[model samples]
Target chain A: METREMTCINCPLGCLLTVTKDNGKVTVTGNTCPRGEDYGIKEMTDPRRTVTSTVRVKNGSAVKVPVKTKTDIPKDKIFEVMDVIRKAEVKPPVHIGDIIVDDIAGTGVPLVATKDVE
Target chain B: MYCRETDVVIIGGGPAGLAAALAVKAAGVESVLILERDTQLGGILNQCIHNGFGLHTFKEELTGPEYAARFIKRVLDEKIEYMLETMVVDLKSDRTVVAMNRKEGLFSIKAGAVVLAMGCRERPRGALGIPGFRPAGIFTAGTAQRFVNVEGIMPGSEVVILGSGDIGLIMARRMTLEGAHVKLVAELMPYSGGLKRNIAQCLNDYNIPLKLSHTVVDIKGKERVEGVTIAEVDERLKPIPGTEEFYPCDTLLLSCGLIPENELSGSAGVALSPVTGGAVVDNTLETSIPGVFACGNVLHVHDLVDYVSEEAENAGRGAAEYVKGQKAGIVPEDDTVMEMKAGKGVRYTVPAKIRPATVKKDVLVRFRVDNNYKDVSIGVFYDGRLERSVKKRTVAPGEMEELRIRKEELDKYPEVKEITIGFVE
Candidate 1:
C-alpha cells in the first residue's frame, strides 16, 4: 500500500488530492472535479507535462522564438526535449503553430512555434 | 509642432490597445490611432513566451505572443492607424495628446476620445527595501524573462527567488529548464500571490520548495550576488529572531508586485483610486475627465490577459460612444450615477461608479478578496440590503472575482444609491 499527497494542476482551483494505491487499485480523495482523479491516476502511472521553451532564431526580428510541444509529453522526457530545443534554430517568416521540430526527443510530439518571428 | 486629429487615440500598443482599436473600428469609428513606445506592437506579450493565455478570448490555450498576434492581426486587417515607437509624453484633459517619435520630433494630436492602456511595471528590488549590498546579478523576473526568452541570454546559473507571484513561479521553471538551479521560492505572505496551478506546475513539478510566510532579510555579496538569507515571519509579517537561513546562489530574482503605469493618466487630471492605483472609472470605463477612458493593467493588475482585452474592448466601445454622442449633442445626466463600494472581506472593486442608463446590457464588476475563504457566499448589497448572493467554493486574493449585474437588476431598485459587494457567512 502506498499513499501520496499532491495538488491537482488541472485547473486554477488546485484541489489538494490524496492518492492511495493498494495492490494496483488507486483511490483519489479531496478532488472537486473528475479531472483531478484522472490526474491522480496519471501521476501514479505516467506523469505528463506540456513543455514551453525558447528556440534560437536566425535572421528573425527577435533573437529567439517561443515553442511548445504539440501535446503533453512524459514528464521524465523534459530535459531531453529541452536539449533538442536548445540546439534548434529557425529563420524569419515563422508563424505561430509552425512546426519547429518533428518527433522531438523521440516523444513522437512535434514542437510548434508559439509566437511569430517575423 | 506637427498636429493631427483623430476620433480616438489609444496609448500603448499591447493587447489592450489592439483590442480597443478593433472595438472602436467595429463601433463605426474610422479615425482611431494607437501609440506604442516599443519598436514592435505587441508590448510585453512579445517577451512573455509561455503558453496558457487566451483561454477565454480565443477559446483555446495560446502563448502570450500568439494571443497578442490574434488581436494585432485583427487591428491590421481592419486597417487601424497605429504608430510604433511613438511615445505619448503628455495628455491633457481636453483630449490634446503630445507625442514624439524618431520621424516626428514633436507632435500633438487633437483626439475626441483617449484610451489609457499603459499596462504595468514590475516592482523593483529597491521597492522591497531588504538590507543588502549592491549586487549585479539581481534582476526582476520580467527583466530576466526578456533576457532569456527575447535576447537569448541566461541571467545566471543559480537563482534564489523572493515572492511567489506568478512571474517568479514561471521563472523558476524557466531557469530550471535552461539548466539553472533554482534553490527555493520565499514568499512574504502565508498564502501565495500566484495562481495555484503555477505552484503545482512551476514549483512542484521541479521539486522547488515554496517557503510561505518566509522572506529574504539580508542579501550578501559585493559586485555579484553570492547568497541570500531568508527568515520566517510572524503573523505581523516581521522576521522572527532566530529563523534565518542562508541560501548560496548566483542570482536573486524579485517578483514582488506590479504597479499600474498611470503617470500619464495622473498628469491628465484623471481621478485615481488610492486602492487600485488606477483611474477611478464609471461602468463605461470613462475617467472623471469625461472623454478619457482607462482599461487593462493601467486600470488594475489582472492575472489573466483575456480580461484585460475584454476590459479594453469595453473602454474602446465607450470611447467610440463618447465621440459619437458629442457629435449628436447627447449628454448624460449626472443624477443617474450609482456609487460602488467594497464591503467586508473585499479589498476593492473596479468601475467605482456606474450610470445605470449608460450601461448597455450588463455592468461587469470585478474585485479581489482581502483573504482566502472557503465555501463562502458573495453578496451583492443594494443600499445595505442583500440583493443577490452567489456561493463560491473558494475565493482568494490572488484570483480576481467578477459579478455581473444586468440592466434590469438595477432598474428594479431605482432608489438605491450605493451598491456593495462582499462576502457573507
Candidate 2:
C-alpha cells in the first residue's frame, strides 16, 4: 500500500488531494470535484500534460507558429516531444487545427497548429 | 489633416480594443474604428503563444493566438473598421482623436464616445533600482518572449529570471524548452505573484528552484550579462547583508510587474487612481470625463484575458449608452453615488465609485489583496453593515477576485453612503 499527497491541477482552486493505493486499488480524497479525483488517480498511475510550443514557419507573417498536442501526452515524454517540436517546420497559410506532425515521438499524439500563419 | 466622424473610437487594437469594437458594433453603433499601433491585431497575445488562455471565456484551454482569432473573426464578420499600423497620437477630453498612419499623414476623428483600452506595459529595469550596468542580455520578460517566440531568436543560452510573475514563469519554461538553462527564479515577495498552476507546471515540473523572499541585488556585466547576485530580504523587503549568492548566467529576465499604459489617459485629463495606476471609474466604467471609458489593463491589471474581454464589453456598452444619451439630450441626473473604500488587507477595487442609478442589473467589483491569506472570509459592507461575506480557502495577491452586487441588493440599503470591502479573519 502507498499514499501520496498532491495539489489538484484541474482548476485554480487547486484542491489538495490525497491518493492511496492499497492492494492495487486507488482511492482519492479531499477533491471538491470528480475531475480532481480523476486527476489524482492519473497522477498516481500515469501523468500526462498538454504540450504547447512554437514551430518554425516558412514564408509566413510569423516566424514561428504555435502548436499543441491534440491531447495530453505522457509526462515523461514532455522533453522528447519538445525535441520533436523544436526540429519540425511548417509552411505558410497554416490554419488552426492543421496537423503539424503525426504520431509525434511515438506518443500516438499528433501535433496540431493552435494559430493561423499567413 | 483629414477629418472623419465616428460614433465610437477605440484607442487600441489589442484584446480589449478588439472586444470593445465588437461590442460597440453589436450595440448598433454604425461608425466604429480601432486604432492599432502594431502592424497586426491581438497585441501581446501575438507573442504569448502558450496555452491555458480562454479557459473561462471559451470553456476550453486555448493558445493566445487561438483565443484572439475567435474575437478577431467576430470583429471582421461584423464589418467593424480597424487600422493597422496606426497610432492615436492624442486623445482629447471632448472625444476628439488625433491619429497618424503611413498612408494618412495626419487625421482627426470627432467621436461621440471614446473607449480607452490602451492596455498595460511591463515595468522595465530602470524602475527596479537594482544596481546594474546596462547590458545586452538583460531584457524584460515580455520583450524576451517577443524575441524568442516571434522573431525566432534566442536571447541567451543561460538565463536567470528575476521575478515569478506569470510571464516570468512561462518564460522560464519556454527558455528551458528552447535549450537554455534557467538557473533559478528569484521573487522579492514571500509569496509568488503567479498562479499556482504555473508554479507547479512551469517550475516544479521542470525542476527549477523558486527562491521566495529573494531578489537580485546586483547585475555583473559590462556589455552582455555575465551573472547576477541574489540576496535574501527581510519582511520589509530590504536586502539583508551577507546573504548574497551569485549565479553565472548570460541573461537576466525581469518580470517584476506591469504598469497601466495611461500616458494617453493622463494627457486626456482623466482622473487617475494612485493605487491602481489606472483611471478612477464609476460603475459604468465612465471616467471623470463623461463619455470617455476605460477597461482592461488600463483600468486595472487583470490576471486573465477573459476578464479583460468581459470588462471591455461593459465599457463598450457604456459608451454606446453615452452616445445615445447625448443624441437624446438626456444628461443623467446626479443620483446616489457611493465611494468604494478598500479596508484592511484589501488593496484596491475597480469602479472606484458606484452609481446605483446608472447600473442596470448588477455591478462587479474586482479587487486584489496586499498579501496572501489562508482560510479567510471576504466581507462586503454597506455603511458598516455586512451585506455579503464569502469564505475562501486561499487567496493570493496574484489573482484578481470579484464580488457582484445586484442593483436590487443596493436598493435594500437605500441610504448606503459608502461600500467597504475588507478581510475577516
Candidate 3:
C-alpha cells in the first residue's frame, strides 16, 4: 500500500486530501466534499491541468493575445503545448474563443483565444 | 477650462467601475460617464490573462481578459459614455471632478454623485526595504505579468521570487513555461500569502519549491541582478545566521501585498480606514461624504473580481439612490449607528459602520483572518450577546470570509451600537 497527501484544487476551500492506494483499490480521506475524492483518484492515476499562455499577434491592437486550453490536458504535455503556442501567431480582428491551435500537444484540447483583438 | 455636467461620474473603467456604471444606469440614472486612465477599459484585467475568473459571476471559468470583455460588451450595449486616457487629477467632496487628457486638455465635471474605483497598487521593492542594489532585473510580479502576457517580452531567463502571494506564484509558473528556470520562491511569513489553489496549481504542479519562513537577505549585483541570498527566518521573522543560501538569478519578482489607491479619496475629504486603507463606508457603501461612494479594490482589496462587481453594484445603486434623492428605507434618528469591529483572530471588516435604516434586506460583512487557523468557528456578537456563529474546517489570512446579517436580525437589536466578529475555537 502507498499513501500520498495533496491539497485539493477543485475549489478555493482547498481541502487537504490523503489518498491511499492498495493493489487496485483507492481510498481518499480528509476531504470535505466528493470533488476532493474525485481529484485524489485522478491525481493518483492521471493528473491534468489547464495551460494558459500568450500567443504572438500580427496586425492587431496589441502585441500578444492570451490563450488557454479549452479543457484540462495531461500534466506532462504543458511544455509541449507551450512550444506549439510559442511558435504560433494570430492576425487582427481575432475574437475571444477563436481556436489558436487544434488539439494542442496531442492532448485533444483546443487552444482558444481569451481576449478580443481588433 | 471645458466644463460638463453628468448625473453620475465613475472614476475608473475596471470591473468595479463597469459594474457600477451598469447598475447606475439600470437604476434609471441617465448621463453616466466613466473616466479611465488607461487607453482601454479593462484596466489591470487586460494584463491578467490567466484563467480562473468569472466562476461566480458567469458560472464558468474564464480568463481575466475574457471576464473584462463580458463587462465591456455590456457597457457598450448599454451605451454608457466613457473617455479613454482621461485621468481624474482632482476630486472634491462636492462631486466636482477635474480631469485631463490629450484630447481634452483640461476639463471639469459637476456630477450629482461620484463613485471612486481607482483600485489598488502592488507594494514594491522600495516598501520591502531589502538590502539590495538598485537593479534593473527586479520587477513587481504584476509588471512582469504585463511584460510576458501583454508585451510579449521576457523579464529574464532565470528568476527568484520573493513573497508567495498569488502574483508571485502565478509568475513562477509563467516564467517556467516560457523557459525560465525559477530557482525558488521565498516567503517571509510562516504561511504563504497566496490562495491554496494557486500554491497547489501554480507552484506545486510546477515542482517549484515554496520556502515559507524564508526571505531574501541580500542582493548581489551592480547594474543588473546576479544573484540573491535567502535565509531562514526565526519566530520573530528575523533572519537566522548560518542559514543563508545563495541562488544565482537574473530576475527577482516581488508580490508582497496590495495597497488600496485612496489618494483621490483623501483629497475628496473622505474618511479612510487605517486597516482597510480605503474609505470608511456605511452599509449603503456611501462614504462620509453623503453622495460619494467607493467599492472594489479602491475600497478594499478583494480576492475575487466577482465580489468586486457585486460590491460595485451596491455602490452604484447607492449613488443612484442619492442622485434621485430617494432611499429605499428611512432611518430613524433614535436608532444608534452600529460599528463593525474586528475581534480576536480576525482582521478588519468592510462596512466599518452600518446605519440600521440603510439595510433593506441584509448586509454582507467580509473580513480576513489574522492567522491560519484550523477547526474554528466565526462568531458574530452584537452588543454583548453572540448573534450568529459559523463553523469552518479551516481559515487563512489569504482568503476572505463573509457573513450575512439579515435586516430582521438587526431589527431585534435596535439599540445595538457595536458588532464584533471574532474566531471561536
Best by TM-score: 2
Assess each model's interface with DockQ, reporting 2 decimals per model.
0.74, 0.67, 0.82
Candidate 2 lDDT tens digits, B53-92: 8978988988898989999999999989999999888988
Report the C-alpha lDDT of model 1 over B1-425, residue by residue, as the tens digit: 99999999999999888888899999999999999999888888898788788878877878888888888888889999999989999999898999999999999999999999999999999899899899899999999999999899999998999999899999999999999999999999999999998998999889999999999999999999999999999999999989999999999999999999999998989999999899999999999998999999999999989899999999999999999999999876745889999998999999999898887788999999999888899999998899889998889999999999778878998888999998875
Native contacts recovered, each model: 0.83, 0.55, 0.83
- Chain A TM per prediction: 0.95, 0.98, 0.95
- The superposed Cα distance between candidate 1 and the true structure at residue A58, in angstroms, equals 2.2
| Residue lDDT tens for model 3, B1-425 | 99999989999999999999999999999889999999999889998887788878988888899999999999999999999999999999888999999988999999989999999999999999899789889999999999999899999998999999888998999999999999899999999988898999999888899999999999999999999999999999999999999999999999999999999989999999998899998888999997899999999999889999999999999999888873344444544589999988988998888888778899999999999988898898898578889998889999999998889888998888898899764
Q: Scoring model 1 with DockQ, what do you get?
A: 0.74
What are the per-residue Cα lDDT tens digits for candidate 2 across A15-102? 7788999998999999998989999999899999998888999888888988889899999999999999999999899999999999
Model 1 chain A lowest lDDT segment of ten: A7-16
User: All models: lDDT?
Assistant: 0.92, 0.91, 0.91
Off by over 4 Å in 3: A23-25, B326-336
Off by over 4 Å in 1: A1-5, A17-41
Please give the TM-score that candidate 3 achieves against the real structure.
0.97
